[model samples]
Target: MSAVYDTRRQSIALSIVVPIFNEEEALPALAERLRPILDGCGEPYEVLAVDDGSTDRTPRLLEDLRTAWDQLRIVTLRRNSGHQAALTAGLHRSRGAYVISIDADLQDPPEVIPDMLTLARADGLDIVYGIRVDRSTDTGFKRRTAAVYYWLMRRLAGSFVPAQAGDFRLLSRPVVETLKTLPDQQQIYRLLIPSLGFPSGRITYQRAERVAGTTKYPVHKMVLLAFDSITSFSAAPLRLATAMGAFSLVVCLAFLVWALTVYATGRTLPGWTSLIITVLFFGAVQLFCLGMLGEYVARIYTAVQARPTYGVARDTDEEQQ
Candidate 1:
């Protein structure tokens, strides 16, 4: 089942894209486990180990692995593009009829890949989502935050977004081509994919602990990702800002009426506390609305500039020729 990239040959059946960032510790385990599952599928496949500007020994390790495993292709980015950008690079470059994007961390098992292919082929599905059914291995905080994220996304981005599905999923060639045409600056595939309204299926699996290395997605990155997801998918935040502004105006009018009545009755307070509080409240509302507007403006600027999301430092497959 060992397969290698042949430029003259027909298209590969499957391409497993693993976006790696400083994943030196996990590379060996990932390769050991991932290769067999893909190999056993009895298909001509290639594994695109997308190196997202790793600052560790990841680049060298991938090179060494490719020496032994010809199917392993190294697609290194010139800089550390974010996860979604790296994924975009892989998807755009993949030569497989079916593409599956998975993280280098083994939390989402590679074993389920064969089942995904079988299900897709038999059911004629264009997308197969790897749904997380049991997350007992994850911390309580992580689980809670994930639940909240998915819930909010469903409400705002539409209910098509599968809960607990991160980037582990399978997409057919047609879906991949469709994604390439999108002009999104921040690619949130979880929401973006489902929004396509494609023929889809799901496969459930229990989450597992990382095989090695620390997590790349820290709390701050998670927060940033949430913001990106929110801004990229929906205008709910801008609408919420509008509602806050209206509420603030109503409150200020009510206070103005109270102040006039107090002055007429000669019971007006001498202190400036109420005036300062009102000023601060209004100021905060204005600032919040401006910030929401700024987020959308920034996205427009990025789209107008048409800057490349990622730069490829090297493609080992291309070098081989």
Candidate 2:
């Protein structure tokens, strides 16, 4: 941290943080759209591009872009941490009166920066989320899964968590500073931002497709993110597991009563199918409860380890050349 950032460097009025991972194909196009928008914003701004150990041409492309774009800065991680960790690193490193986190794929447009800033100032808001009103570019499966994800998050985390909001949002200095102080190793901005309980505004946009390259957030990563979001924010899963266990007990007791009544009537039902079905049903319920409990335990295990979310291998700001 000491080597990368000069303590004497002046802070800007606004900072836009983009986490990059194997986004080589998208860098040039992202710059093309991003630079003008930042320049037009009327306030001093810097773009902190966090390179999460991209193995492609992304690092070189960033270096080349920085040579031309003075406001662009690079923070390279030692390894490829997940999307949230990269974002956490950028947010922690960024120094600005207001910080906005956007994606490198350009799906979350840069054109909304001015609007976010304006709304934040005009309405005296601490946070402004760039919500997507339309996502017709997404595939049907994606749309369905996303809807379910947001629904589950809201149900489990309470109504405070805003739906249809990604990491594309603006946070005031105080909010950003406060987030930095939180001890959680997993940083899910969607839940984290709304939980701040700040006066907030929203600017809706139609979500666009990637300008270039493949999507970094594949299905597996999405599952992990969903799991992290649930485990980090709410205890509803644990409660649900408990409820299921109780219901299973009730069902088992009812079955026992029925079996005893039939035997007492001297008409014993030879019910191997019923026994098999009952065994399977109870087994499934027990396994489901165990899996839910395991999710929480895994989170607790990670927390007790107290490992840093990410580490920097090198930073462009430190380079003298």
Candidate 3:
């Protein structure tokens, strides 16, 4: 049966939104693998391929594909907003009962879509996360860092947050609507979705290597994403600053006792070395805390200013279909 909103209004079963950067070479293979699975879902669907100001031939490639595949809708941003902004654009533009966001590299299988749709329909879930069951394909650095990032995120973002779930996931219309209403200047949907406390389910899959082209997310981008994830969702960094201050107090007490003992014993020694070491250590800790606090303040400043996260220059045929 087709996914329907109600008997009256026309609504698509799924809207798969793929964020693209300079991925011209990967576009064709991604489409070839993803389209058939979507068609076989036995429901009306739309693929929102959002172009994040690609400098390569990606824009032209998407345009050419649109003529052949009517369901392939394209949304071109005015400038290269980062991956998350592109996702926000696609999310806002999508009109479907359930929305799924994935990368254009085809690392996450399109085949999982059918099963996700089924589970959502059957169990009445608000969200279904595509959990990575295996990541043997990833490098040792990636695997180790991913583990640490998720571990830290779970502690800070609460226990409901999934460990291995990336951007690949399905969200019901209600969840989508909620996300649109949130005033998140930097969007991280993994944390954003869990914060809602929706009735969510999980579907496991093996993470594969890229189908073609280079990965859009480099080391720098990954680090940025991790930073956003931490600062956006939780105020743990601010709290950590408080902890650091407490530790600094304890150290000061210990130093004071030592100074008193040295004075009482009439064994006064030159304290330039001790003083210098103490100053450097405390200064470093204080600066690190300040930096962490600054990150949060920067986000707050951006939010209060109320800036638009992204702007769309054009869309494929008005995105109505």
Candidate 4:
């Protein structure tokens, strides 16, 4: 009994997974803030920093920190595989009873982690998300757009996705295991986490602006994320295409009936304009439907190829071991 107890205790108390890109400036500050919190918890914890092919000194900085902090573990991907894939890599590699994922930008605030941990423990919840109560630092346009996006996602996805929720969240071991079972290569963790039917809650915090390094999620990445999120979770776009096709067929039938009535009454009028308009309209609709169909087909093709989601360029910890 004592041997089994000791083995369980050494497995892992907690693991914090931070996916880093060119975040050289923020890495030290993040470590400084997080180290104390983990120490305060009176439990053994390790920080897994997954560097996703950073072009800057981010990899070197992580190595220096690892030397100073024995609890630090680093994983370097072969190339830039985007944020979600990086997070997935870390989660799979982590060995912890509880795992928490956060951005390295420092905007998510490491201080809120304890609160999330507390909530997870008190409620016996499998997942606890850090929800942003306010985003005053964000531009007005961004704030409004985010609100609309969340609203639309909830309506279309038919899932209770908490508003203002980002990747900063805590998950129990069960939740982490369930996440690994999901094999979708697109990797939308935010939407996929809530669908596991686990008891969950939220910790509200005010979001702060980034302290260093440029925003990794620029306009282009934001657009891609929006597209992936919408396409992965909902069939609303495909359904809309179907509805449009039916509506167009009805309109064509109405036009045919009108033409027959005109001929029966012996009213000969130049119908070239109406005929041209109909042709263009239907042509546009067909192209639009085909485009939508192509998007789904492309996704399917990518999945069937079964490519490795990411490759590891270098791993310092693995070498040390």
What is candidate 2's lDDT per residue for 1-321, written digit by digit as tens?
A: 232234324758888899999999999999999899888876667789999989999999998998887778899999999889999989988888999999988888988889999999999999999898899999999999999999999999889887789999999999989988888597888998898899999999999998889998899989988988888889888888889889999999999999999999988977999999999999999899889888888878988998998998876656744
Candidate 4 TM-score, true structure as reference: 0.93
Determine which window of 10 residues in candidate 4 has minimal summed lDDT.
Answer: 1-10
Which parts of model 4 are misplaced by more than 4 Å? 1-9
Per-model tally of clashing residue pairs: 0, 0, 0, 1
Candidate with top lDDT is: 1
Can you write out model 3's per-residue Cα lDDT over 10-42, one digit (the tens) per residue?
A: 567789999999998999999899988987877
**Cα lDDT computed for each candidate against the true fold:** 0.92, 0.88, 0.88, 0.86
Q: Model 1 — TM-score against the truth? A: 0.97
| Model 1 lDDT per residue over 11-45, tens place | 68999999999999999999899988887888988
Clashing pairs in 4: 78-311
* Best TM-score among the predictions, by candidate number: 1
TM-score of each: 0.97, 0.93, 0.94, 0.93
